[model samples]
Structure formats: C-alpha cells, structure tokens
Target: MRNILVTGGAGFIGSNLVRELQVRHPEARIVVVDDFRSGDFRNLRGFRGDFVTADVSRLDWNAQFRDEIFDAIFHEASITDTTVHDPYLQAHDNIEGFRRLLRFAEPHQTPVVYASSAATYGICSGVQEESQPAAPANIYAFSKVQLDNLARDHARRFPAWRIVGLRYFNVYGPAESHKKAAASMIYQLYLQMKAGRRPRVFRAGEHCRDFVYVKDVVAMTLQALNAPRSDIFNCGSGQAVSFNEVIAILNRHLGTRLEPEYIDNPYAFYQPHTQADMSRARAELGFTPRFTPATGIPDYLGSLSPS
Candidate 1:
C-alpha cells in the first residue's frame, strides 16, 4: 500500500493503528481525517503524515483531496459514548459519516475497514457471534448496527468492492485518556486505584466484559486489510472476565490491596456480560489475541509508568 486514509486517526484505536502503519509500511504516505470531537492531538505526537480536520459526515471528499487515490481506508471515526441517549445525533454522526465515507471510496473501490462494536449484541448471554441478530440497547450501539447494514447493502450493490467491519469488544490501552468518562472500565478502575481510592464498580462486581488490549485490536484491524473476502469479524480477547476479576488484576499490577466499592449501575441498558466467539476470525483472518486482563493489565500499567 502506497497511500492510506485513517479517519479518527487521533482517537485511541486510530492513533495506535496509525503508529503501527508507519512502522510496517515506512514508505507509505498516510492521511488522517478527524474532527477532534472525541479525538486528541496528543495521541498523534511525533506522527509524520498529512492531516485534514473535518467531520466525516459533512466532509466534501472531492474538494478535500481532489485526485488523491488511496490504497486502503480505515474508518474509525464515530460517536463512541454508549451513554449518549440522543438518537438523532448518534444515527446521523455515526451512520451518516460512514455512508458518506463509502460513497467517497466507491469510485476507487478502495478496500475499507471500519470499526463496529460488540455493544450491538446488547444483553445477549454467552459468546457473541457475527451471525447473531443485532440487539443494540443504546443509540451508540444502534448506530453501529446501522453501519453494518449499510456495509452489507453496499457490498451487495458492488460485489467487487472490499469492505470489512470489525465488532470490537471492550478495548483498553494508551491514548484513551482523552475519552475520560467514555474510556474503558479498566482504565477508569486503574485511575481510581492510583489515586489511593477504592475502585468503584456496579454492585456485586460480577458483570463481565471481554476486555481486549488495544494492541490486539490494532493487530486484528491490520490483518483485516488483507482479508480474502469482505466480512465482519469479532475482535476481542475471547475470554469473559468479571468486574471483580478486573479489580483483582489491577490490584496485583498496582501492588495495591484496595478493594472495589460497589455502586448501583445507573444505566438501565447496561450489558451484563460479553464474550467473543473468535472461531470465525481465527479461521478467516488468522487472528490470535495475545492479551487478556491478566497479562494486558500489567503491560498497560507498565506503559503508563515513568521510564
């Protein structure tokens, strides 16, 4: 790939993917597009690439880059806050942004890989598979479901085009500090413990999530660019760890005996559990997640520590 486009390149997963692309394809010219709504420039420190500050939903692609041809396009820009209750804003920004991006890429048939979310599985129990019907509990998740629907429709219309969507589970790592409240639970818990306070979690601390490290998510994303066919795949650690287990992992890494302070889960649509069924990803994309909470937490904490 000689030239690539990464939307939301200043965000957590996008920033990590941008860095990896630079290392893997040193000669390629990367162009990043972000509106900075949920993205932080700090994440792109020392990044050597072209950047366009604009909202993907309202971007005039032809006017922005008249004749630039892209080898691949990574669509990561979206309203990621799950607590957002505004249906119109979520649908317009997340879904419309993707629709416009597809229209821009269709001419070149640029292979596009976009971010989807496991939240689309809603309150489903057990492992989440790609084939399962979407049951989005919030506007944010519903937007992602719409994205998948749009991708499917586009694929059917243009069978020769390549478009892959990845349903990410709970991802946590560096560059996500900017997300603040929307950041992963792992990061939030780490911060609480670091401040010499007991980590707070939903009561009983038994709600489980499949916390996959950002590095693994990026790896899976890069692999998706080389998929033989366009399809959605689950990107996660493939293991379900409870909130109490996460607190234990943090305590072990931080060397703190701080116990979790249980609190009521205020959100009425919270997911109780999520685990990814990665058999499809393994067979199709050769994806093998390298980090679970036990290992990922330590590595992430080490990265945050002073050198």
Candidate 2:
C-alpha cells in the first residue's frame, strides 16, 4: 500500500487535500500529523486515516514512526497569520519545522510538496511570477520566503529528490470555517450576508487578488508532488478580481443586493493587487485553475448551508 503523510491535515486546505488523497488513492495509508493549533478537528470528520497529534516544529519522527517510509509528504503546517508580528515564532515554526521535514525526506528520497505563499511578492506591479524578486511586507511573508529559499537549497543538494513549493494566492472554499478571521474574504462576506448585514470592504473595495479555489489548490498540489521537476510555482487563477466583484458575486448567489460597506483601510502593509502569471505552472506542472468567483460562489455558498 502507498504511504503518505500530511502535516496540518486538520486545517482547511490540508483537510481538503486529505479528502482528495483518500478518494484518489483509496488503498493508500494516509497519516495526518497536526498539532490542532489553528485547525479544527471537525474538519477531519468522516476521514479514515491515522492522526498524529503533534506540532510539526516539535515532532519526534523517529519515536513515532520508527523506520516507516513514505511515498510523499505534504508540508502544510505553518504560522499563516499575516497580522502576527512575531518574527521569531514564524521562523521557528515555519522555517525550522520545514528544515526538520527536509532532513526526514533526504534519507528516504521522498518527494515533498510544500505550501509557499504569494505574500512573498508583497507589492509587485505586474503579473506575479515565480522568477520575480521577492519583496516580503510582513513577518508571515518573510517566513514563506525563507521556506522557499530553503527548498531551493534542498533541491540543489538533493537533485534526485522532489521538493516543490507552491506560492499559493488567495485560496477559498469549503472546510475553512475553522480559520475564522483568517478565512478568505469570500467566506467572510458569505457569513455577513447570512447574518443580514452588509459585507464590509476596505476603502473602495477595488484591491484585487488572484483567488484560487481550494479544489484547484488541491489539484495543483498533487500535480506539484508528481511533477518531474523540483521548483516553486505560482498557484492562482491567473485572473485578478476585485474585492467589490467578489461582494457582487456573493450578493448574486445569496439573492441579496446588499451593498458593501466601505471602511478605512487599517493595514499599512496591504497589497493592492495580485495576478499570477500561469505560464510557469502550466508548462511545468500541467496545472489549470478551474474556478472563478462568478462560477464558484454559488456552489461554495450552497455547501455552507445546513444539510
């Protein structure tokens, strides 16, 4: 049987990826390693897999698994809160945790597909590309950039091992309620509309993001793991949409014409725009994002309703 390990499997994207992995490889032995720090255990409900309750930063791999080998490793655990100002904590968990995983993978020559972030391109002017210079505006972005740099070094040292990093843009979908304030703006808007309140936005709500759906993110992640090359690629829809457009889409889906309440922007390090250049991902990993807000909001909102 195939063996796989997913860190942060109780978190939003990680849980979704766990579900997809189970479906695609039914006979595979999937082991989830999560500390339950920012993740909700309910996200893993109905999941058939072994759960290892431990922080990635402090995991004792040898003590738990002994000499068991893994076919692939999905490294998703990290300090993802951008508003957090704790650089030391970010470096310890996000950076040091990855270093530990790399050491584990090196001996096994296991393929690793890890989560990077678009935050690395804090204020890029044009389409964000993998080859462009990294400009981190916050500690969270700095952590991801550090991870990517470490991945590059690992790739060079272990030429035969696959170490792919995906610089994910704004990702949204089901199983993200656990994120709360950290959830996608799309989800935040949905909740506001459900409560009969106007969804709030910053200033004119024109700031754009290349919001890629969770399903697409999962698909691309799998592709990255299986790809022949070890490199970092941008994971996004390759199309930028304004926050106002997202609110409009939510309004249309919920059948409520509620206007967005504009407020003063509080984030001094806010990114005004982001659009992924998909050529690299397409050419390298055969990744094509399948969701846009217009096409995806209805299904997403429907999933939120009580069944």
- Predicted model with the maximum lDDT: 1
Off by over 4 Å in 1: none
Q: After superposition, how far is residue 196 of candidate 2 from its true place, in Å?
A: 1.1
Model 2 TM: 0.97
lDDT of 1: 0.93
Q: After superposing candidate 2, which stretches have Cα over 4 Å from the reference? A: none
**Alpha carbon deviation, residue 239, candidate 1 (Å):** 0.4
Q: 1-307, model 2: which lDDT tens digit per residue? A: 3999999899999999999999999999999999988998999987898999998888877778889999999999987677678888888888888988888878888899999999999776568988898989888998899999999998898888899999999999999998889999999988998899998999999999888889899999998977787999999989999999998898777789999999999877677889999899899887788888787777787788844
| CA RMSD per model (angstroms) | 1.1, 1.2
Clashing residue pairs in candidate 1 are none
**Model 1 weakest lDDT span, ten residues long:** 264-273
Scored by Cα lDDT, where does model 2 land? 0.89
